[model samples]
Target chain A: MDYDPMVMDDAESLGPVVKISQADNVRVKFELSNADLSFANSLRRVMLAEIPTIAIDLVEIEENSSVLADEFIAHRLGLIPLNAEGAESLLYSRDCDCDNYCEHCSVKLVLHAKCTGGENMSISARDLVPAGDRMHQTLGMPVIRDEDGLGPLILKLRPGQEIKLECIAKKGIAKEHAKWAPSAAIGFEYDPHNKLHHIDYWYEQDPKTEWPPSEYVDWEEPPAEGEPFDYDAVPNRFYYNVETSGPLGPDGIVTEGIKVIQQKLAGLIHELTEGEGGDNYDGPRSPEYGGGGDGFGYSTSYGGNGGNQSAWGGAGGTTPFGQTPYGGGGNTWS
Target chain B: MNAPDRFELFLLQDGEKKIVETVVNGMSNCSDFTIKKEDHTIGNLLSERLKQAPNVMMAGYKVAHPNVPELFIRVQTDGTVTPREALVNALKQLVAAYGQLGREFQKELALRQYADQGENGDGSGAQGGTY
Candidate 1:
């Protein structure tokens, strides 16, 4: 069967449906489908392993739009402009040993600076911690700096505009190995002009081949053949068709679409079976009631009408015991 | 080659709804409306139908409840629908139009069995596949 790579890629690349615009602040509006919700819930659990504190920072808020940060990301590395005053040691504790916040696990960067003037400012852990030392154990030190002595960082805020940063330290291994790694990955790309839609189809490639292949490719699978088709199985093939409106809300995901499809498919099965002519035919059975007589009538008895006694027996003015049926013989004495 | 023993018609979505009127009114082709025949099983027939009409641009097929052994003809439109209304209409139409086909088909099968018995001169002929 010839499968369209585009369709395959789209189906496999399902994830949190996020919409981000450069014109807006560094905020992403995530619309999660049923499948995406599972991904989100799993990602949330994984993130909670290391970073336990999470909060959403809304910037340049619109009337009906709000931006949400990944809970795991926020919990591990505090969002910039927010600080953990004394929560720095939470990163070094083994009891709190998550992939993100152990001694060799995390890095905390506190950036306090007034932006000279610009529409946006971007900062990341790499800017504060040295690339090699990001996961290395180290005492406190400034990782990056700007001319204003605010350490290694970038600020585009207007004059007198200040932002505070509180970062919790942890290991980078989890962030590195997370299924949904936090990076500038092009989740999906569609160009109306080119009519080309490229989706990032993530899978564990064969460790036997190469880390990064020479030529560009859209798919990956694990090393062993045993794991070859594990992720790309049948039930996983269906994509949730989220409605744009309803009680689910514009950003809400609907799971009932798949159920609806399954039902239709079942109905088709019925049609096919019945349509196949005599395949399902079975011979008729004898009627429940015997061959038609006066359906309710009883069989006749032997004697003629005058000689025939009723089935109950003869009834006279007086009963067999000498008491009349209703009032014995209108007895005035009684 | 035989027409279906019984067939059902369902208006899965009423095209009269204002929201679906525009697309349904413009549909000039009923060629996609189709019927297929296969051995009766719980899900096989419907699965094949879905594969045949994966992306129904204008309308969708209607189906009776999963357990009901009846045909369903649904008129689909590229919009949302209530399954209840669709099912009621389908049942009504099936009774009115295709009910006789089911009875006649049953009779035909019976007659074929009787004829087989006469030819074989044995009771086992009733179990033959000639029908």
Candidate 2:
């Protein structure tokens, strides 16, 4: 077998590879309300239209499956029951007119009874049986169950006739609001291909002015005659201003205030390359700093070299705040 | 010959000196004895008479003899009444005082079981008793 050395070096140059083996991240938030269609109806629509089965296959799902799967699991475990009466009430709404309960609406099943009699009993659409032959237990099955363990019993029912059950539907809107009106805007931004890249979430907040009036206006004049004028202004002039205050109505008053704010920009750039004297330039040549240019090179007649040797020497020579230095002069520069 | 209203007999063993086995049966030939509702009181009276004979051990027996009410009597080693004897005597005295109350008690128990069944009124078989 031929081993390629270049391949190994290439892999090493790429640095430590940290690949995401499993990217099954999901987040879901549910807002419940009763003014709109019942929560049971919204959930039913999600189950029937979006995802058919309550038990979703995590391996086969895409990014958005979390919303459906979360609601399914929550409903299966009886976590979010109908609460039209109160927060803790688990009754489904009885107003839905659908022959077979759909996502739109259904009745709430509060009470459950299990008989040890020979005859079978008919349960309402609100009733639920956790496990049965007619139940949508597995994935890819029909969401709505027509018979739903409701047929007549063939054999004699004896003691210990077990029936596992829960509520049939919930009552609330998809977005929780007492008035049943849904707000139009909600969104999030992320790189699906690479999750670590960036993520931004956006939601509506109380509207207000984004940018307030400037507290100061800066004014600048061109440099004067002699002494090598510093063309760049050290500090700019600022103008201060304020907006007026007024009363909106008989009981409401609005006030606007403005003030000058000082801002500072300071940073240090370290050169990685070793050098002796500022002339031995070994650092990143940024185009913005006039180091690399595609056009003709223009040299300053007065300056000794095109590089910033003089300014670098002056700044690097002195140790700030009486800090100790390791061997002064050219050796320290190296 | 008139039938004896009550019978009394002391079973004994013949020896050089006669040994009284036990006063197996003891009854007064009259119906004058008032029935006591308390079983323990009846058991105390039976124990007292049985302990009179010396070297005699009163063996326990169930009194189902005809013309006499059934009684369960126990003879203790030291003339002390056992709880079982007291209970049986109490039950016997209750039956004697209230003649047909035993049949009525059974009927009431059956009716209770029927009511506990809720809507199911089928009384075809013996209703399972709850302790």
Candidate 3:
């Protein structure tokens, strides 16, 4: 057996035997070592903005006499996290053959709450339930629940006030709207003790007190006071603490983030190889969801928006008709 | 801002060479390449990976300006393989590594009996990792 460098880049070469140190429903913590900072940052970016999740994209309110405006209520609904366990199995509405939206692409949820008594009634995510003719499993239901009925109150209804609405949940990436974000905040840090001085700290009295050292200082050796910093050092290991918003699990977010990044690279590789003439393309192009192959169909909303700003002239948005680079088997890199 | 912007980096233009080979001013086997519409994401990662190859003499990348969405990578190899081939291999390896990581995560999840979602167990809300 010959030495396979790639396979050999396992536990020993990885330099750390650490596992995901902490994990729960809404958060996950892990260490990424023997990796480049760019790779770590890229993964963090994808998890924050590219990983897809289900959210209330379109809402239709039938009756609303509550104190809150219809738009306000709808906006709150959008922030609520819906279980996105099998969101991968659902097709982007644009990719589906249906005219508007179908069961294959959209999940309909309805909220009905009325305050008929004198006491004020609270409207929460728990009040929202599956609404459809067919079977609605727990997969797409809201994940948040508490003693006070899925607490994270949307609004309070007064006596004689009522609200009735239907929500259409669709798959989308955070790049489209933050409502689809998988995590609220991704705690990413490297060189915790500033051994490399990647950043220059400002100070009036003491730099330590002014810009307090990262709590992760314990992870790295504290730079000796007044010791010369390593000018040529580059960030290699990283710490990732992902706080999910409940739409997806932290594990799901991390795994899906990797898959999305692979798809992006696969998409680019496909373009690169196809441009070089396909016969020599030996890179793996696994057909995964949203992958340029497999079931990977790039939805229009998957690209840039607002602060993200990486439109690339809209990767899947401007394609001829609705043909995505991954969806069209006949389409070339052209 | 009139900047090329981040997401615009991913959109490849027609007839545009994503990666281009340019002759170094007066060096043989030493090459400088420009990856259009990219940033440190590709430049830094690819350069770091290239440096690990025994054939690669030196590898580094830089961006001319924050506004410019171009990645400049300079690679010199020890006369065995072309810098272009080294770059392509390193890039593909990075992708493969990501795939490997995904499988490891799934394996861990499988050990935990798989899909233990909705537990929403309370207490210990403190954030912790590598501590």
Candidate 4:
């Protein structure tokens, strides 16, 4: 068959009903109907890998005497979910017009902790203060708190130990690194269907009754008549469950996942139909979740999509978990 | 297809506030709800499943005091819809997607199984004759 990249079909699909059974900021559940398996799988895939989240991709450690190694600390910081509320106003570092890093593309976080006396100390997310006004000015502090309203514990320090570092937070997908994943758990399953049958308790209570079975445990009151008891079977219907780690709420993750997928599909359609001039393709951009921008440009690199990072080439210890081994330095690069 | 008799299941202490004793149930713990200990399985299953709900505000479960065996499951919505309603809707979405995946798998299996037939030019699978 000739190469025809099918992004979407012309035929309209039926709309599914969304019934919320429980909800909070990070966890949620709902029942959906009329949707097909394709939609649910696509949604799961998108939720897991497509959603854009802000995470510390680059870390520069200046001084470290703490128990945890530099890379371990960096990994912990990388996994900390920043409040990505105003991320839309910022461009992907690669896409920004700046030659390298810019305020519009990245958030700089600085953490300097030291303990000189007495007992060991604790360092948490609240200590990593946002350097510039971007996140603080636009989205507020990027730290997320636990259910007890405490910041996520990043590391601990003993007396006379210190750790000073800088982190660059950027927008990226979970496919690149799970640190950017918005949800902790997301799953669904076919609903089970079963029926109950009323037992003749009066007859079954007799020891000699073989028809009703005396051995069967008798209920205090006979069950109301209804469908006969049978094995529960998986039906076409499903039960959905979602839990968020931080950043976006569970409901927000699903909504954003669907929107992100739609945008990507549209972008793909435009690319296929309009040839190589994808830059000039007029397909609609996915509206950003909270505000600021309209276009959803998929960047290939963690750096703003098209920006240069040759100066810090040696700093590229790009691994699945955030790990960068940089020689100790005191200068903060913009 | 809708699941019959969809309901919230929870195990509450005799005098404990229903919300506090359980895991994260919603944005707040003001509702008084209870369920049989036997039905705890339903909550466990659905609790694990609901984490995938779209736009979920929060998702978590608490089983504090194991000796007492009380399980708390809370699903907070983003306010786009109520918690319970979101659960039903999400399930439908999942079922739909799974169905599509099954059909695609079958189609792919059939093609792979019949690949040799197409090579023989029987017009059963892959078209031949030109590059």
Tell me what TM-score chain A of model 4 achieves.
0.66
Ranking by TM-score: 3, 4, 1, 2
Q: Which segments of model 1 are wrong by more than 4 Å?
A: A1-102, A116-156, A171-334, B1-131
State the lDDT of candidate 2 residue by residue for A1-334, as single tens digits: 2334464345223322111111100111111111111111222222111110012111211222122353443233332222121111111123334664433332323324454556644333234333222211211121232356332221222343433333344333221221111111112111122112222324255212333322111112323344463443122111111110100100000000000000000000101112112222222211111111212122111111211111111222111111111111212112
TM-scores vs. true structure, each candidate: 0.18, 0.13, 0.71, 0.50
Return the DockQ of model 1.
Answer: 0.02
Q: Residue B18 of candidate 2: its Cα lDDT? A: 12
Q: What is the TM-score of chain A in candidate 1?
A: 0.21
Question: For candidate 3, what is the TM-score?
Answer: 0.71
Candidate 1's displacement at residue A273, Å, is 50
The candidates' interface RMSDs, in order, read: 30.4, 53.7, 9.1, 23.3
How many clashes would you count in candidate 4? 89
List model 3 lDDT by residue over A78-109, tens digit each. 98888776666667775577999878878889
Q: Is the docking of candidate 2 incorrect, acceptable, medium or high quality?
A: incorrect
Tens-place lDDT per residue, model 1, A9-53, is 363344223211110011112222212222233223222222111
- Give the local distance difference test score of model 3: 0.65
Cα error, residue A218 of model 2, in Å, equals 50
lDDT of each: 0.26, 0.22, 0.65, 0.50
Docking class of 4: incorrect
C-alpha DockQ of every model: 0.02, 0.00, 0.21, 0.01
Ranking of models by lDDT: 3, 4, 1, 2
